[model samples]
Target: MELRNDPQSHYALNACIDKYYGSKGLPCLPYGGVQIRTSVIDGQIHEDVYEKVYFVARKYFIKYSIPIDTKNCFAMLSFAIGPNYVPMTWLVTEENESKFRVDNTTEAVVHNLAMLDEYLAGRLI
Candidate 1:
């Protein structure tokens, strides 16, 4: 589906970024304007490949002491502004009410994170 970029969505998107990223940056836009760069969780994939994303996310859950159960959450990409602020993968609860950034460093992750906001209101799963 096409992503929404109306005034209301932009405002809400900015607010969400501020809340999650804090003072790091605000008013950041997706790198390529309304496109998802990855299909790991956003589309169909092989079981092994799909698990790779969770494997990475789970590592962060343990390192960061995130309390959410593994089965109850899904992974999504994060919004990043610049070089110093690399994009991250996020573990989001099924309810979509809570999210925690996962530690990931790779060009593919960066592209996915940058374009994720353009899909499913910042979600892809």
Candidate 2:
């Protein structure tokens, strides 16, 4: 999968998620203005393969916050094996209008990109 580093291009992430999971009709929640959800069926059949869908989703949302606010949003992507396996959830929030709080590492990368974009945009304008 291609990693997007541009904040303005966050629409790509939504497209990717829609292409992959939208057809499945998975359950999702609204978190920080982003729709968060999980895949019901395992995309791949492999042991010890930890899926990081939530983190990835959160990253994209938080990373592209300059164009929007990531607060007042809640979403989760859970993994389960026939009622077994622990599910994971990722949530994001903004302490203030400018600062974001995320619970995943991938989201951190996104946040940095957002800050960079905002800073650069400010300088350019």
Candidate 3:
């Protein structure tokens, strides 16, 4: 969760995340997830609208220790929003990309990576 989050909200969020990490052997953060970007116009990229996330900045790796249930299901919980923590059930994607999910009810398989780019922008599952 490479956070350069609001200073006012950073403390509690960090603490909650830390507690989860402590239980996970402190492997640090989960840095990879398929993100779906939707801010573009009709899925078309605008040169002027594109922005670099970090040219060179501090990276806050956010991670958690979640175990799958008896049904081989588990959700990734996030406390980055302070009190409004969010969770997304484990899903199977084409690449499996560690912790990536493609949410589409119309199709069972995920083909478009573009539709998954927003997760990097802090979109809830």
Candidate 4:
């Protein structure tokens, strides 16, 4: 089933992303999921991060026997972390741009990317 179409699965994926991303005190279940924005300069880096995060999420889902399609889940994950599909103004202004880059480069983000790198490289699997 598509994660975006099923409310339960959508919330589950959102919670999984949020918890793994180290977001605290945020809504446990966001109906439409959360959006993480990035500046133009950091767009590629955040894309790479989301790729890693998707693989990590896939691994966890398989371990837990979650019956979600890989492609669909990855697409949903992309929408959640990618700077697209939201208001362009979210990343347009110079002030928000810097903050967006900073938010995307947090220590937690770096660590998740690194860990997923190892996992993908057959070291963490």
Q: Which ranges in model 2 have alpha carbons more than 4 Å from their true place?
A: 27-30, 33-125
> lDDT of each model, Cα atoms only?
0.31, 0.32, 0.30, 0.32
Instruction: Judging by lDDT, tell me the better candidate of 3 and 4.
Output: 4
TM-score to true structure, per model? 0.22, 0.24, 0.23, 0.23
Candidate 2: residue 42 lDDT (0-100): 60
Q: After superposition, how far is residue 125 of candidate 1 from its true place, in Å?
A: 20
Q: Which ten residues in a row have the lowest lDDT in candidate 3?
A: 48-57
**Collision pairs in model 1:** none
Summarize candidate 1's per-residue lDDT along 42-98 as a digit string, tens digits: 676422211111112212211111112234333344332332322233333454323
Clashes of 3: 10
lDDT of 3: 0.30
Q: How far is candidate 2 from the true structure (C-alpha RMSD, Å)?
A: 16.3
Candidate 4 lDDT score at position 108:
28
Candidate 3 ranges with C-alpha deviation above 4 Å: 1-5, 30-125
Question: Candidate 1, which segments miss by more than 4 Å at Cα?
Answer: 1-7, 24-29, 36-75, 78-125
Across 6-77, the per-residue lDDT of candidate 3 in tens digits comes to 343233333443344455444333234322222346887532211011111133332232221213322233
List residue ranges in candidate 4 displaced over 4 A. 1-4, 23-125
Please list the Cα RMSD from the true structure of every candidate, rounded to 1 decimal place: 14.6, 16.3, 15.7, 15.3
Positional deviation of 94 in candidate 1, in angstroms?
15
